[model samples]
Target: MPRANEPGRTVSSRLWDLLFAFDPNNTELTLADLVRRTGMPHATARRLTLELVEAGALERTSDNRFAIGLPLWRLGTLAPRAETLRRAAQPFVEDLYTALRQHVQLAVLQGDQAVIIERLSAVNAVGLTSQIGGQLPLHCSGVGKVLLSHSTPAFIDDVLAGRLRRFTPRTIVDPAELRGQLASCRSTGTVVVKEELSEGAESVATRIVDGRGKVVAALSVVVAAGSIKLQAAVPSLVASGLGLSRSLGWRPGIPIRTS
Candidate 1:
């Protein structure tokens, strides 16, 4: 177990780690797995896990396993940044999905990861590993790159200093190359990712601005790699992003800067 006064140590933080350990790929966990993953004693893990279950943060399965509960997912809907923005952007996102018949996604920066707040899927669009509430790395994903490009200078430097995991052969790991790409995104108001995160998925993303012209979120359309022209998708993506931004009180006169 971590010491109480250790840097960034807290009961709530540990609790969150326990919660995040559950994912779509690993929805069920045994007590021993929880204990090992959290590095907490079996007794402590059981007690805390029981507490989370009582609080409706985790659900107990018929087989005695634990998974993330719907209550926690509902609580995430209450986040103002997500609730308000997603609600306002839903119609526009839907329209874009209808027009393009592709995977439309809305994302925002949460720490160093891009969290998918909302997504509209076409019946036969390119398959994506990401889902609602799933996270994507900031260096290789379309929405991630757009969100990171608009982040603070310190944050940019910190992300560059950290490990830049290569998801595919085309993933950009060089800081200088990524810096140039971000600069181009800042000027063009869009980021086109070609098979960076997934082997055969491509995404075109644009930044959504708020009333103050701050890039609050990113909107993207994922398509099959090399099948669709990225430039052809830019206009629709930009229009949808701007429409959502306008719904958030962004005006045309304000200059929207990217990175």
Candidate 2:
């Protein structure tokens, strides 16, 4: 039997189920799909869906399909860790992107995923597979590895115990190999991923720290595979990460550590 907190457990949970059903891959749905996805009665789903639409958490498209609303996006912008850190890092990220003429991204750990908070892309740079609000796996992408390296041991173990989807041939699906990669990231304070998330892309990522010297975010620059050497990009990425960290009040002589 399912627990009380399981799917469709309560009205609130059903509402959340309705909301989270929208994702990057499946961003729009009809009311019938919502009922099927949430396992709620049609009338109940209609009521809660309408309530959410009224609350501006979801929107009705011109085709009468529903999707995540602008208000929800605004609410997500209010997340202190994401919004505040993005605001603090924007200028530095912009400068770095301008200098490198590549895709620069800022991301933070949200549960078991790395969520992109902000991104700046060059028109001539490699077409990226990531979106501003998209989530990436912790075992493959550069930003994901940086965030995972800074995460708690328990969280690491939990992720390792779960399914690690292989997005590409280079994606690290084995727990042991991923552990070694995480160790490397901890030792070097940076992560470099090549063709892991996408076949023709490479990412160089570094950690961002707060005044307390704790890792709070990850900064990454993605380029077309083999176009730029990873070693050449590392110094600039590390410097930008430190600059943003300093902007957040992180200073010299403090014991810097990942979260």
**Count of steric clashes across candidates, in order:** 0, 0
lDDT of 1 at 82: 86
Q: Which stretches of candidate 1 lie over 4 Å from their true place?
A: 1-10, 257-259
lDDT of each: 0.87, 0.87
lDDT of 2 at 143: 92
- What tens digits encode model 1's per-residue C-alpha lDDT throughout 125-187? 887767988999999999999999988888899999999999899999999999999888877
Model 2, span 154-186: residue lDDT tens: 889999999999889988899999999999998
TM-score of each: 0.88, 0.89
Candidate 1 has an lDDT of 0.87
Q: How accurate is candidate 2 locally (lDDT)?
A: 0.87
